[model samples]
Target: MASEKSVRIKDIADRLGLSMMSVSVALRGMPGVSEKTRKAVKACAAKLGYRPDPALSALADYRRRVRPTMSFAQLAFVTDYPVKDDPFWGYTNEFLYGAQKRGQEYGYNVVPFWLREGGMTRKQASSVLFNRGIKGLLIAPLPVEDGHLDDLTWKYFAAVAIGPSMASPQLDHAVFDHHHATQTVLRQLHERGYRRIGFLILRRRSTRVHHMPLDAYLGHQYRHEEDRRIEPYLPEALTAEGFWRWFDDQKPDVIVTDAPQDIPRLLAQRGLKSPLDVGLVCVSGQANELEGVSAIIQDLKAIGAAAMDRLHTNLLRHAYGPPQHAHGSHIRGHWQEGMTLKK
Candidate 1:
């Protein structure tokens, strides 16, 4: 007698003088197997000490769930943003495009679920998604203050978050390589004969990314000449008054910032012009918007695509709830030369 682990359904079928299909249906209690045959199959299975193998069941299930031809399931991009103020349409639109494209490759369509407009509580939204057969979630960036995602039922789905903004529940995340981005910016500025570089960042943005930029900036300055080191001005929010004060005090030859929209005007107000009186560089800049500012083109879409990839892998492993050991995937961005910084 073979061990139960070595027994196959076909082996039972051979002994019972029934077809493999009948044996399978009977042992599994499917409709095609009558009561007498089902009982006989069960008795024989017991006598043979037969047991189902989870690995075989999982393999069959995986084959059933994923096919090369077309999508069989959906992934949700869950956000708390109001439709009108959706970040996806603004700075993060590229991220959405990336996620969608990658998801399609794996036969999964990524759909947006706006949490605020629907007026559904997190639990309600979870229920709706569960009913709709959504098994994976790509949690987008939320307000920096709202670190935890305790509102959603974490156990029901496999999830990965976009960026450090999703702090709690601590799912695996994909983020811009802010630390590297900052380093690249500083190195570029140094190579271009600029010193006394100051960073002006809104406190919220700095906090949202766990101060990686700040740490990188400080670390870089530490190893450089003392004259080249300038203190960063981190106001609670960006303001013209605060900007001038920092400008007057630090006298940075070049300013590095995430928000560059107001820098041109701010420079103008102080009787300064970019690349002449001052060099302004945006650490995170979109190609189209920051027309004249030298910047690091953060690949937001690539980050989204990475997050989708992580979520897909988790779903394949049937991983749910908080990860046992959370991880982060960092994406490096490229530098775009603009008119604001000296070439």
Candidate 2:
């Protein structure tokens, strides 16, 4: 039954038989408070359910002869996809949850802004953020065809890219090593005595032109002298019919893809059971379980959380410029062994 009105520092101080200033320093973990006294005050404060009003604390500090401290107003999570329909919402939700938890601990709030709403141009987005006094940004992976953000100025705020390295010279990014991930999957398939491996991917200008996984798949296929097949589906196509036709024709013994559901359904339609006539491995498994599909699970949630951590570090150090290629911190893909692969 403790409402916000009853959870003040004075209530705690009165109960603990301590001065407000002593209790304040102890609660804030500032110096000048003895260890024993601090512990006692903290225990009493917890017992009374005392919580400091952040707004009032900021105001009080400003009114005193103290130098103004930069309070975290808002950190913007910008994405090009529509909020409701984007397939990557699950990943985004995890990222936001991680960010919110960390932001609360550091005294900040995260604000999400979708690019699909109202046709947000870079200039318009920048103007809106500037007006709202938001100086931090975390950009999720945008379509590669959208190209680099040319309209937004990087000098005004700190920013970080949350996925693959876009061709932007004015941003810091944290991205998974797509080549490494593909190599891992291919190597696993190779070790399992599966020689004829094929890759299916959506053919997009962005993917064909810039995606590294496609290049890696092609390179690996050529190097091993394995019978390689590629079924390039239309970028906008997601029907089972097109996938079934391709599956019937290629008839690869083992295949790797991003969509697990489509692969299983296609196989089922063709009267081919997985791990019997064909093998399956999903490159980026987004679903709850692999079901029958073996997958190279890239922990995207961890990637997003790490990106925020890097962004916060850069902001604190005031380092803003082109994306520096970070060494030593590699994005490792975890292999989930499933029943889809043949022994």
Q: RMSD in Å for candidate 1, one decimal?
A: 6.9
Whole-model lDDT per candidate: 0.82, 0.68
Error of 2 at 109 (Å): 2.7
The ten-residue window of minimal lDDT in model 2 covers: 61-70
lDDT of 2: 0.68
Tens-place lDDT per residue, model 1, 1-343, is: 8687888898899998999989876764433566699789888988898988879876764664465437347888877665646545466657778999888876678988776655888889888988887878998787555477787888888999887887688899898999999999999998998878888888877887888899999998899888878888889977888888888888888988988888788888758888888898888766887777789987788999999888877875557788989988999989898888887
In angstroms, how far off is 146's CA in candidate 1?
A: 4.5
Q: Pairs clashing in candidate 1?
A: none
lDDT value, residue 93 of candidate 2: 68
lDDT of 1: 0.82
